[model samples]
Target: MSDDEFTPRLGKSKGEDGKRLVKYGGRVLAAARLAGSKTGVLTRRFDGSRIGRGASIGRLLSSRDRLAGFRARRAIVKTRLVRMAGNGFAAARAHLRYIQRDGVTREGAPGALYGRETDLADGKEFLERCRDDRHQFRFIVSAEDGAEYPDLKPYIRRLMAQAEHDLGTRLDWVAVDHFNTDQPHTHVMLRGVDDRGKNLVIAREYIAHGFRERAAELATLDLGPRTDREIQQRLRRDVEQERLTAIDRRLLRRMDAARITSPAHNDPFQQAVATGRLRKLGAMGLAANLGAGRWRLADGLEDTLRRMGERGDIIRLMQRELTARRLERAPADRVIEGELNAPIIGRVIQRGFSDEHRDRHYLIVDGIDGRVHHLDIGRAAATEPTPEGAIVRIAPRSASARDVDRTIAEIARENGGRYSVALHLRHDPSASQAFAETHVRRLEAMRRAGAVERLSDGGWDIAADHVERAAAFETRQLRDRPVAIEMLSAAPLERLHGADAATWLDHAIASSEPLVLRDAGFGRDLRDALAARRQWLVEQELAEAEGGGVRMKRNAIALLQRRELLRVAGEIGSELGKDYVEAADGARIEGRLTRRLELTSGRHALVERSREFTLVPWRPVMERHVGKPVAGIMRSEGIHWQLGRGRGGPQIS
Candidate 1:
């Protein structure tokens, strides 16, 4: 190999002459020694080798000083990694779209996406080529002085070179520079395969510790170690920062159990910075002078500062999303957060990852409350896909099992600690076959999950505390589903008026719930929609003008809802190239999964049972079983899939 080509130097070794070769700074030294030092006392004050105690202390202090400066500059660069697990190519595409989103440059231009081998403008073909890779890796690197440079491509290239040198192989990667935020950052994506066509596995320590250290080293090389003046200036500025800062971290660490902070015990410079921070915190009611150079900290000081920092981040996200959409909101409106007690009915303005590094998601909704709300909706897969302009209602999801759990337990108690579809139908003969089957499906799901015991006869031996166990099971599953989403209308509000189907506007007007419309943007638009629908109702002769108010005919709402369902069914049937088939109460349905279709009423799954098919309420579980055979009983609410993996055939009612 040429001198310029990289080589891996693992360790020292012995030659044929029995000489020890020690590796230092990538060079092998044979029997190396301190050339100028005396045998016992050592003459040189300091050299590249260890000698006397005085020289050792001096060298130690020198190394620490250099390290201190390095650490101070390291804080300026942020490094993060995102692992693309399943459908890596799809993830690669999604990440490219996100990083290259419009207005992500300093000049408000669309981010120019580029990879090592291909420009992002032709990203589709490049991603298709990468489809066979097991996984992809996305990395983000941002420098504190990144904005100082007109373009960040050179710095990114330098960083990647450093990575290649450290990783001991040529890497396959792509990158895009994003400059919209305060920090100009680069998004780098790497194919998971290495130069030898083998899976590239990076150590967790290397990702967490090594990558940032190298990035910081490169940054320091470019920008130079921060001067004492620069460091002091930053420390002074941190005194008044509203969010968590280095000063706050220090204070939290140094405070006594009595809630008192005494910076006098620290270095003179740190004492001054801490005093200034305490004064600033005092102004914010987070600190108080306890006399004698000590200050009393507020209870939950760290938590309060963290929350404030989070709120600031949320505001920035809301503003960035709004600006990208060319929309604006009033500054006076506080961003809603945490668990909401009631559902927010609105049209989805946009949906995207909130924390891309963590795969957490968020939504921007134009709510009926007259405000554009930003909601952090946890994982993206927990909720169904909602296209922009789709009307949806978002409610806080509960971990506890529903009343259905209690109903199943009662049925099991009546049937000798067991429950089955046949037994359920015999006991509740008046109940719709679909409804009874729904209970059986619930039991089947619980049994499959090992939350409840299932007998060989397709029945559950549910205990009195089955609901509690179900809730515990849900909690153990994951904290990914924080919000329950229901699609109210797949079509936009403007297109719903004058249509021959029922719309959300009609229900809002005729329902007993108070019409609380916000008089801004989408809220005002919805108000206009409600008025227009009222007029349409009169024109359709569904209601008559009575004493300055329109009087709807008896069961008009029910009639309109039925009409909407039939119209949706007709459209679905047209899509499937077959007639709409409604499953009878006791009818059994079995078929290969087709696809899921969204309608005005709700989302439905099309199950083709050999030339004929029926639309059933779509369940999330069915997504994995698509294009595979499924068996279930048609129940009142929906079809229950026969997920046969247990003792008796796993069937849903």
Candidate 2:
């Protein structure tokens, strides 16, 4: 017989020559030995004894209770699966950048600290291998400090190995250890596919309960059971924590008559600890004694504590920033909260992450008020980069309707309760044409939002409460533009000396308003800069030394502004390879959008016209229309953009 004869002869089992098999025959063969383990099934022992009919029910209940207890005890790992959608190339780049952000590792370094099951250096290539993968995984895992003896990377690797075994396939994953916060944790980015190259769907229970329990089990095995002294110490620390402490959680669980009663655990040490915590809370005004076994908890206790905790963090941040700069603030000027009575005029000193995990940002400004203010600006993307040394105005943010709404209402009232571009011009013939067009754009925006109705003849039906409606609209948009930043001057302080521009320093010197000078950080620096600027002006013949004081030219502000515009135009001209063309006030600008440049004033967009080009205030809409034609009316203040070629097309600010 040949080797092929040893192989079983193949037959059509589904055909008439063979017997039929039961449905799910493969499952039966695979789980034949575990048939008795199914729910609601009773098992018989070899001793001719049978377990109770409710045995499986009890088992199910026990398993659920165990999981619930594990979660309550905080003996579980934190794991998340962040999906990577859209273009594979963009996702790959973003993922790598995110994991490599500052302060990501235990050593306070950039990039991941560990890689599991594969080489860490080949992260890009690993990402490329799954370029066609529809969804990728970024799993974050954190374990309790139970196993403090071993390195976090090896423990994480063991967990991943266990996962591979349970899933019956190999996995490709990379991990990073972050110790920047109180919690020491690891971030694991795993490919969504299995070894055979198919989408791997993990069961929700496995992700939620199984992974955590497995990690906990391995940690417990390595470190042994937690000592009583450690457990008590943890509880003691929790009692004094500001943000949602464990004691508060326990009180919530055992509340009666709006108060927490002592537990009847019969453990004297635990009972004494609970009573001591109650007494501490009473002293802090968070709890009060009502009787032998009752207490009165403060209203909104949790919220107040959480706010205090946040303020504490803010204080710590302020101190750190000041220390790093080798600066100090008076105790009264150290902390600032709520709205400000007056705007703080200052130079930006530094920018940093306020809540690093959430990407919230903060700016450290050296104010002329003789103090450094830490301003928490909401998000990073919406914030314009106000580079260090740029003077800025930090006012209490107000989200109210501006004068534009009032102007619109007055124009409409004069036009028989109807507002149109032509009617606006007729109402205010003295107003600049571009300015009149802005009111029309405002009306168009209101009409689109359904706050005002547009008539068939290109006029708006102005209501008596039109101003109120517009105010409501502005309030609704406040969430995105939380702060309104007014640019004083776009030129850097260093270039203000002998520069062909009327910079902020020049404006400060020429204006009648008093300059609030302080002998402090940035303020002292500004004083020296202004003195040097005067000398530079005298040397350039723009100023003359008269009676021991410098006097500027009569049209110095205007001349400097013009010279600066020409200098900026020259720079843009070189970049675009076209001549500079200045657009007169109210002139129509039609061109293809080029690129946006960030200057001291704000963002500006270069518009490439036929043989010449110009720079105008950049609008968000122009970003999407880059390389496409854009038409707008340029005013002294800003441009009122027509989105398309047609006059009746949509307009944007």
TM-score of each: 0.69, 0.66
Clashing pairs in 1: 434-635, 434-636, 435-636
lDDT of 2 by residue, 1-653 (tens): 98866878665558465666545765675576476544544555553112312233334433664644222324445544445564345645555667677876667788663566443556677678767776666665666773353457787789888878766778888877667656677767777888888886665546655566667667776776667787688777766666666667666567776555553446676666677777777888888887876777787777887777787777777787678867777756664534455677777767766654333567777777677777776555445656776778766555566687887788778877887767767777887666766776777666756788877766678887888998888776454345544555445566666565666776776677757888876677778888887787788787888786678888776676667667788987887689987778889998888788665434678888778998777776576588888888776677778775465555665
**lDDT tens readout by residue for model 1, 140-203:** 7877677677877777777677666656667777778887667777877777777787766655
Q: Judge candidate 1 at residue 493 and give its lDDT.
A: 89
Candidate 2: 10-residue stretch with minimal lDDT: 48-57
For each candidate in the order shown, give its overall lDDT on alpha carbons: 0.71, 0.68
Task: Give the RMSD in angstroms, all C-alphas superposed, for model 2.
Answer: 11.8
> Local error of candidate 2 at 524, Å?
4.0
- Model 2 TM: 0.66
C-alpha-based local distance difference test score of model 2: 0.68
| Model 1 poorest 10 in a row by lDDT | 25-34
What TM-score, to 2 decimals, does candidate 1 have?
A: 0.69
